[model samples]
Target: MRATALSLASLPARPHKTADLAPGTPAAVVTAPPPRRPRGRPRKTAQERSDGNRRRQLMDGAAQLFRSKGFAATGTRDIAAAAGMHSGSPFYHFASKSALLFAVMNEGMASAVQSQQQALAVLAPQAPARECLRVLIRHHFEVLLGPRSSFIAVMLYEWRSLTPVQRRRIALVKDSYEAAWMPALTALGQQGLLQAEPGVARLFIFGALNWAVQWFAPDKGKSLDELTEQALALFIHAG
Candidate 1:
């Protein structure tokens, strides 16, 4: 009897059907509904898609204003107005003016990294180290003085305005961007084309290239190709 009772208790519970009920008999068994599966994340709406674009607009406008007027001199209202946003709108995207400044620098460094990668990607797989260095110099000029110049320009000058924590964060990205040039510099040093040590040469080369932002004028001075050639001449010895 105990074994029979255990077997009966162990049996699966069968769902009750109304048709299985005897006439005038109330159904004695009820089953709870199955638990629902958790839902996946919802798709972004059109407005949500535009939020990224708005953030980019704010960064671009802030970069231009910051480069032109200096970070301290520029106000959030000025950035919003330049971006065609309402005066108070920048706060919606950034917690404070310093936060916006850090965003501008962080995003600017990211863009620089991407541009450098693209510039290097186009080289032939077997391209010489000199060619790689040349591409890097030309792209550096474009980054500093070309159509996308404002972002890096802001990064160069407004660096002092960022807190130490922000500086360290931006430095990581900046280091990665600079790392791309090392293999080429090392190769050139191996070939005796580089006059200085590869590491020292890298520092000197960037110092020279970055200084162009102060005096380079597209209309009045050498074109980017001419500048690249001159930089190569200055840094690399003829083989």
Candidate 2:
């Protein structure tokens, strides 16, 4: 009995791995929570995408009608028919014919500004100012008279058709579009190629260029290149 008790006492008790843990304390298991969706208004891109497609169709249809038929003569039904929509469909995108007109003008000016900036971007930084001016004039001609040029054409003839509030909105975009010409005109003036004050020169230059929409006949012998050359000769010193 004594030998048995001594042998049992010699065996060490198993080590207590949880000795430091307080009684009844459960181990915590951590797991990441699921991602939360943004509250208040679900994703709008999907909605805008659908609206955008229809809006673009409406604008394109309106542009064609406003170009061929005068803005005054064109109606919402005509615009909707051109776009392959019901007569009442235009009201979904635009409130009225005048609103549609404003959108076309604004879009036209915005497009013009973007194209001009892009054209200038590709030119070499060291390109001569006269050469830059020539390129800019040519780009302007292309935008004003190129295929799908009806948008600006409508803007050119329908200025008085907009309400004063609408006119102000369109003017804001127009000013930005015209401002792109300033740097090029300034460069031309510094190079002694320009004849009039830069500001006056800009007005005269645009006046002559815009008038081309009415008279210049591409079907005949007139090319955009010819117009650009003539404009340079008239505005810049030949030396």
Candidate 3:
């Protein structure tokens, strides 16, 4: 099972109460969320921007390698070479392979979280509880069905590798993301509108959205709109 921010969140979850999307927004275009640039590093200049882009490419290539194969199976040389750099490129941007793995996962999750927040923002005011959920589901699937799906699955299975300190820090950002949907779910449940237990509702909805990483292909009639409609229909009628 995937680890959702919902299962063990410490903060209160709140669903959006209103939304203002143009009725049909593509998941890929949910607003260009700012990428999760690594901190502890100074901002880049024009020259440095080129270097940063190169470094990002290396990290992205490494992530692809790690996701397609297991971490233990991929070596630094493979990643560096794939990124069009020598065998030491990953070390230039990350401390070690573990750091690179975490960074990739962190960036992917951050992008997803940001997209969710953007989608939620449009719905946070007057959208019905159930309607808000359908929107959330759509954005979630859109974000995952892209190339980052592999990283997502890797993160799900490799979280145990994170250090204790790293774990908590990641948790903080993740909690905020999950909390976006909690308010509406809780409110609906209280009103006898939720389909099942709170945990189940949260898990099932998240699971359906998350599962897109497995077999969702744009060519199989599984476009973002189709998934969005299906998810909305499933959850809305479940009660």
Best by TM-score: 1
Per-residue lDDT tens digits for candidate 2, residues 118-215, read 98888999988788888889998998999868889888889888776666666776787788788878887887788689999999999999999898
Ten-residue stretch with the least lDDT total in model 2 = 15-24
Look at candidate 2 and give me any clashing residue pairs.
Answer: none
Sorted by TM-score, highest first, which candidate order results?
A: 1, 2, 3
Candidate 1, residue 14: Cα displacement in angstroms equals 49
Best first by lDDT, ranked: 1, 2, 3
**Candidate 3 lDDT, tens digit per residue, 1-239?**
22353333323233221111212311121222255566656544433334346656765786678767777888999988887778765575666676666666666677778778788888758878887877777777766776566656666656676666555555666677777888778877877777677767887888777776666667887688887888777776556
lDDT of 1 at 216: 92
C-alpha RMSD in Å of predicted model 1 compared with the true structure:
20.9
Alpha-carbon lDDT, every model: 0.78, 0.75, 0.66
In terms of TM-score, how similar is model 1 to the real structure?
Answer: 0.76
Candidate 3: residue 29 Cα off by (Å)? 28
Model 1 residue 25 CA deviation in Å: 67
